[model samples]
Target: MTFSKDEQPKNIPESNTTDNVAVPKNFLIPFLLLSLKQWNMHGYKLMQVLLDLGFTTIDSSNVYRTLRQLEKDHYIKSNWEQGEEGPAKRIYSITEEGEAFLKTCHSSFLQYQQMLQTFFSIYTNSLFPISNFTDKND
Candidate 1:
């Protein structure tokens, strides 16, 4: 059900659903950084490594674009590696900044994981009560 602006409840906040995001923004960043931290590799290999790690629904274009952005943001660095039997490949490695960012992301995700656990526990437990959630506006 869609709500028109005029018909929407004043007390309810605007919804920013997952639909607004093609994929969770940077959901793949830490994985990419962590992969680089472990072993520097070219884009194709990196994606393969990620797939091996059980990450699905990955878009190649988005991965390349994100890699370029990471390079621009100084989180990662790439250099062209001349292949013996193939064309040169751009090797990606995590910078110190990227490693630091990955650590931060790990910590934040742990906390988020806890919150999700709590949510699921409450959702699955019959002891849960809808009235436990009180509107701040009240």
Candidate 2:
């Protein structure tokens, strides 16, 4: 299933936030799927959860698009439910494949965290080179 250009969400917020780190696009699907594992929700609710989790600038369109993609990729599944007070809602749930994918994403995220830690260490040491810690023993 291909999402046409017009189908994509428009006018994404320019700034996510000045405080919290913005969620990377690659991590979006994993995050959404993980949340679905916790509880099934419709697109709007999913976007709300993401926004509440420090992603203040997330676009609903992007969230919906990601959901569609996840469904196409077999990482997630959805069912429409008729609402008592409003239109039907499409509820999303994580599939077994999604669970496996979430595990992979978690593993990769951990590795990425370790790499960032290593980089920070190198940066910190570079800024303040302790004489005793240098390769050349004085």
How many backbone clashes can be found in candidate 2? 0
Task: List all candidate RMSDs to the true structure.
Answer: 8.1, 9.6
Q: What are the runs in model 2 whose C-alpha is more than 4 Å off?
A: 1-21, 128-138
Writing each residue's lDDT as its tens digit, candidate 1 over 1-138 gives 467889888755468564333345567898899899999999999889877876656689989999999999999999999989889999999999998899999999999999999989977664656666678688
Q: lDDT of all the models against the reference?
A: 0.85, 0.84
Candidate 1 lDDT (Cα, whole model)?
0.85
Q: After superposition, how far is residue 26 of candidate 1 from its true place, in Å?
A: 2.8
Candidate 2 minimal-lDDT segment of 10 residues: 8-17
Model 1: how far is 37 from its true place, Å? 0.9
Give the C-alpha lDDT of model 2.
0.84
| Best model per TM-score | 2
Q: List the residue pairs that clash in candidate 2.
A: none
Clashes of each: 0, 0
TM-score of every prediction relative to native: 0.72, 0.74
lDDT of 1 at 30: 88
